[model samples]
Target chain A: MAAQTLLLKGVTKIFNKGTQDEKRALDGIDLAVAEGDFITIIGSNGAGKSTLLNVIAGTYAPDEGQIAVGNQDVTKSPDYSMAHHIARVFQNPTMGTAGGMSIEENLCLAELRGKRRGLSWGVTRARRRRYREVLKVLDLGLEDRLKQAVSLLSGGQRQSLTLLMATLSLPKLLLLDEHTAALDPRTAEKVSHLTNTIVSQNKLTTLMVTHNMNQALCHGNRMIMLHQGRIQMDVQAEEKQKLTVSELIDKFGETLKDETLLSCEPAGAP
Target chain B: MVILSVLPITLQQGLAYALVALGIALTFRVLAFPDLTVDGSFPLGGAVAARLIVEGVDPSLAVAAAVLAGFLAGCLTGVLNTRLKINSLLAGILMMTILYSVNLRIMGRANIQLLFRPTIFTFMENMEVVRYVPVIIFFFIVTVIAKALTDVFLHTEYGMALRATGDNETMIRALGVNTDNATVFGLGMSNALVALSGALVAQDQGFSDVGMGIGMIVAGLASIIIGEAMIKPRTVFRLTLAAVIGSIIYRFIISMGLRLGLAPTDLKMATGFMVILALGIPALKGAREGKIHLRGV
Candidate 1:
């Protein structure tokens, strides 16, 4: 078996614990992802898909559990500190970058991820050349507009840039929280394609949470279905390849029998 | 004739307070922190400098000490917000209140007079004995240097991180920046600039009054808003330049108001109105364009 890049044991995250509106967003979620494993997660609203990602990314600390990233226990690590091992692309493309800053500045920020940022110039001549090469891959002609503010970019372009930033450091685990959900269909397809190519080229260990059934079935080496904070199905390799999108949809339909599943808002919220 | 005579003094005041404008921009625009600490730290700087100078400390050293004190005052606000989890606005307000007492204690009185005693300006005068550096020229040079430093720092790697914190906290945090450090450090730098300005202004005016810092934040914000209105700055270099130029023009406007028989005591109220006008006009324009609607209108 490949080395484990991430291990979560009895990871439980409760929102508003012990109050009238207490929510067990993530109830004892146990997951282990091997190195270079691309695991796509699909679940209905409030199924803890985003919450689980947040827990692993250290955005929200698991109330009762442990998370080990490549042998380093990170249950207590704050999100900023966890950037050393984890990089993330948010559902909102604007969330992934500083909109007022320039394109090259954003790329420079990603290049220095998990490193000490000192008093040196953020963009050097050599780094600029490297950034140009990287931007050329996005094919958005961003290399020429390196000094333009990121706010000028469309949602899809921003998401694409965010994806590049996320994978730039080749983090131990990359978390995608519906990264392409805000994009138009065509743009979403482009960004999704770029995500797959980048993940495979780098052999990254990625956990992507998506509401799209085809996205789950068509990408990744393993697939997991979450229902009401519990994993209802886990399929991998040959099993994942043989599973059809309709089968996954049926599984989702079976879990939708409960009505209380739609109320949690911004789960794992602080 | 009255307006023309007020020009030189307005220019001097403009240069002196330019640092305050830059400091506010650093916290509010760059770090996205609405730090009311300027109202406190400004006098805190003057008080520290005045007290130290009275004790026969070197003028430059006194200014440096005042800057250091201002930095610590700002860091105190940062700690309250970042570590203690207090709301940022409340944190600044608390620190501003606390500094009032601290400033009073440092001066041993409500005000101090430094009239014929030595100051950095005197030090410059001594240099002028050899090369003729006019006090006005000295103030201009000091503001220019400070503006250059601000522009340079914003382009630096750590500076970018701080700016990003203001622009988007989550994005910078996810890139491994400890945003708490960014905020605390940014506030320190911001207030340090304000303090430096306060120290210099107290020396030039020859007195550091306890009430000197009142409404200073609003003044700084007005300067920034006016500066941006004068020139829509898109780059860091232009942005810092805008603050400096904005302060000069703000001072000019105030001088014009004083010339028009405006009561000096009513300056703060006039400034308050100016800020409202500057901030409200854009929204009003948007409303007129049908982008927004006012129910009462």
Candidate 2:
């Protein structure tokens, strides 16, 4: 399995437990992500893509089974404590970085992630030079505006910056949940390109959940189609590379029909 | 001549209140939480400091105790919000309500008179100090230290996470930053600074009244808004300086109002009006700009 980087074994999560309107967000799901595996997840609105990512990121506690990052059991670890090893990029660009703080200050914040935070000088000249060098790699001219507020940046620029911030310390896992969904089409394309570049350069083990089918198939080394809180189809690098959008659509249709047929068949038909 | 004589005293008092305002700014502006616990915690500090001093504790030790007590009161509010899962505003109100009784209990009454009792001020009083020199120096030293500490803390890795919690709690938690802990710890530090201000105010005024904290948060807000209005600094150091300047201007306006036949009893209303003006002005300007656009359209 190329040495698993993240593992989820028979994991389940129930929101509002014991309540009449309780939701089974995840139902005994099993997932294993190997090192350098960039997996794209896709599903309908109510499907458990986000919920699964939240569970792995330690934002939500699973009701059963176990989750591990590498060899460490992080099933019960709290969010901030896990920040040292795991980084996440949100859908909203504004949510990833502090708006009022300058780009350098935000970069400084990302650089200090997972370390003992102390009261000290922020954004020294040397640090600013280093940040400029890092930003230059984006080819977006962000290096020239190091002192500018991050809020001034465009959506694509902010997302690109967020990607840099998230990977600054090179975390063990990177979670992207519809990160470019909120951006305009052009900006989304730019951010997606940036995402591909950064992920490949860093060799980051990534889980990217996207709504666009083409995007799901086009990027990442692997793809997983999720439905009814479980993995419906898993495709590896070689198979995924050759998988067409029409093929994915066909598989999705097949899965949907199978689910409908099983539901109609019986109450306990295994 | 009278104004000149009192200028230094007013400036000193204004600076001291700026620390309190900074504390308020942390919760209200930075964290975006309406923490009513400032009202109770402020007097709670005075009560703790005055009571400790009366029992012959060193002035510095008494002030430290007061800060610690304020921290606990703030943490109490956080506990109410996080553990009890209460609404943040109500959690602050509940803590404030409880703190009134706690302050009274600590003081053994409605007030603690520290007059003639040896205090930190006493040491300065005997050192050939000018009428306002000791207090101003004390205020300057404390404000600088507090401002520096705030700047450094906000810049740290954990501090950025704290700021991130306020910016977007859900995303921050998903990034593996504990939003709950950040909120609690931030609130604790905020109220501690406020209580420290209360302790210093008690020493300066020679008495700590249980009701002294009423309208304190409003006053603090006014200072912060006014400071931002005057010198809009993007850096943390400049932000703190703006807060201090805003406080001084606020006090100066209040004193000017008093001189212009404004009643002392109407001070709270005046403060409210000032805050409204500070908050409303920017909005009004933006609205005017919008109107201009509509006319052009």
Candidate 3:
């Protein structure tokens, strides 16, 4: 067995604790992700998929849990400090890059992720050449428009650039929160393909959240289904390969059905 | 050019206040922080410099101290906003209020006169030149250096993080940069420049009055608006140049208004109106267009 890349023990997050509107977003999630695992997460609305990623990324501190990234006790590490080990891509294309900055400038900022920033020139001649090489792999012709502002790029192009930047640093863990949900179907397909290539090429441990059951099944070596705040079904390798979309949806639909029935009625009240 | 020598003292004043405009540009545009601390820090600089100069300290040393004081004031405002969770505008207002009393205590009175004392403006006195020539040259040199330094700093690695902090803070923070510290640093640098200009202006006018910095922040905003109207600021170089160019043009307009018999007391209101017009027109037009689109829908 491979060493675990990220280990989560009894992670729980409660919004508005003790208030009448209090809700448990994540309920004691105990997950251990092994090295080079690409896991796809799918669940009903408000199922705590994103909450899990946020907890792992340190965007939201878990109310009760221990999050260890690479053997380090990082339960209290803040997002900015935790960035050295993790990088994330969001659903919104604009969230990953600065619109006002040029492509080269944005890439330069990304290249220094987890690195000390000092008074040296940000984008030097040599660094620009390296960036040109890094950008050429996208086949988006972005290398030719190094000075163009990111605001001018199309949504698909920006998302592509963002994906490149997120993976540029080769972080220990990459979190994608519905990264392709905002793009057009065609652009989403292209970006999905790119995501797979980048993940496999770098051997990066990744956790991706998606609404599409087909996407959840088609990609990732492993898959996990969340209901309420707990992992309902987790299929890996041989078990995951045999599981069809229909089976996955049937299991997912039953959970939704249970939730609606559970909410709409008081069992044995009548 | 001899035109600088032949021009009225308004040009020299414009050159001196150009530093204030640069500071405003750094805080307001680059850092996207609307710092009202300049109003207090400007006088803070003047008071510190004036008092130190009177105590027989080297004029240059006094000016440096003033700049340092302004930097600290700016940092306090940053801390209030980032650490204490105070609103940026309110933090600035609080710092400005505190600085008012601090400046008063530093001066020990309402004003300090450097009329008979040797100052930076008098450094070129030994050189034979046209009247007001030395002052204009000194201010022009300082403004240019300040502009150049700002441009260079913005292109550096640390500057890139600072610019990113203002543009998309979450993105930068995700890249392992502590945004709160960046905000504090940017505020400090901005106020330091404002204070530098304040110190020089006091020496030039031969008196540092407690009220000298009133409405100064608004004036800087007006200068930036006027300058941005002339040229699009796409790069850091053009952005800094825009502030300098804007300051000169703004001064010329103010000088022309004074020549046309406008009351000096009314100048602040006039500047306020200019800024409103400059900022409002584009926004109003956009809103009107948005309404038109809604009607079309």
Candidate 4:
């Protein structure tokens, strides 16, 4: 598989522009993710971590600057237009898969993602067997429940399935926006571990947004803290590995204080 | 004696309406799209078919044309919602209202009578079967074909994508399906079936009135609810079948109500009440359990 890189240059997004509610959700941000890079992004409320992921996923076009996935410039692309190369798992487990659809059916939808869906059957016997094989890896006993509706699955199982689905076709970039946040702690950990397994197995380039300080410090090879619509800190390799929870918390607290100061500006202020 | 005669007529009416119920299930259940266009598209089908049939067009060709007309009407509704950014319910209402005028133009009048014209049902009249039995049989065949076709279609890749589009638009969009197209296609297909039902019903009743489709949406919903109540719709085939069976049972219930001294004009009111009761039951049960069932994809 040929590796792919993602590049963002001077990306800016202002929600409710030119209004009293106008907020600079993202401002002049530049980010370059190399091939096989897994980056964790941490931010306090409204810090634009989710916005950054959304912009990259083509959910929102950047008001200024360019976004390139692999060699393709997709700055103005719609969400579905970029989905072939970009897979996403939202914070809600229910957002990742169709609840009313069966397990095998959901997997089939994922497997055929970005591919032309023609007159062929969605879930064939062959594909069902393949899905069973794949579900076994989740260790949630979902293999035997291939025909069951996904709604019947627990949150952890659903999130695990979502993680699996996101990486099923090996997207060029996987965007996870606090995918495990809605689950119980134990389930979250299980999904987190499954995420690590899937990402490494596929050698996928991933951008995960999280609120957990310890999780941000522990999971990815690189970490970035966002405050006031900008990257407050970007830690890599050895710097990220040696970062302790308290140290990360201190940095987060320091930036959060600055964010409050930034938000206190008078009306109509830039 | 009246009950014996009413049984076959009611069966024909019920079976014909099975198509409408199935179409409603497609949008409301499969796509989770609350489309009001069915109300207009139903009569639109009858208007188109009645006009063409009266113009010396082949009955089959007229029916096909009616289906096509309905499909386009549904597509317009979907476009209004997906492209024009109208709320879905409002989009459907807009289409339904516009179709009222369009249906009038199709027939160039408020209603068209097919009494002297040969329709698809005319073939069954020449058979040895009893008058009502032949009509019932004809409708039975049509409903089954529709149900079977839909069952097979739902298992296909495009059908699955359509279902997913309704189940979760955000996820399907992320998965690379153009949900706007899906919405358009789904709504169009849904309305086509409804129009087909209207065409069939108009031919059977010997007249196509612009007001024929009034309250049809609620009637379809009632059929679906009644069908589901009788049998759990766990599979695509089952759901489609349930819609048909529900339509038949709904007819029986209406017939029973009429026999019980309810006026014909009270039918719509009864149907509306039935739907409200069916929809409210689950919510009421959930409330009793101290929970509210919030519905959405």
lDDT, candidate 1, at A218: 80
Model 4 accuracy (lDDT, Cα): 0.87
lDDT of candidate 3 over A1-270, digit per residue (tens): 898999999999999999999999999999999999999998878999899998898889999989999999899988899889998888989989998899999999988887899999999999899889989989999999999999999888998998899877789999999999899989999999999999999999999998777677778889888888999889998787777765554555677553422232222211
Error of 2 at B119 (Å): 2.2
Model 2 chain B: weakest 10-residue lDDT segment is B288-297
All candidates: TM-score of chain A: 0.94, 0.91, 0.94, 0.92
lDDT of each: 0.87, 0.82, 0.87, 0.87
Could you give me the TM-score of model 2 versus the true structure? 0.89
Q: Candidate 1 versus the native: TM-score?
A: 0.94
The better-scoring model by DockQ among 2 and 3 is 3
Best by DockQ: 1
lDDT tens readout by residue for model 2, A214-245: 77877888888888888888998788878776
Model 3 chain B is weakest, by summed lDDT over 10 consecutive residues, at B288-297
Provide the lowest-lDDT 10-residue window in model 1 chain B.
B288-297
Query: Candidate 1: deviation at residue B151, Å?
Result: 1.4
Clashing pairs in 3: none
Q: Candidate 3's C-alpha lDDT? A: 0.87
Provide the lDDT at A60 for model 4: 91
TM of chain B vs. native, candidate 4: 0.94
Candidate 3 Cα errors over 4 Å, as ranges = A257-270, B1-6, B286-297
Question: How do the candidates score on chain B by TM-score?
Answer: 0.92, 0.92, 0.93, 0.94
True contacts kept of each: 0.90, 0.48, 0.87, 0.83
Interface RMSD of 1: 0.6
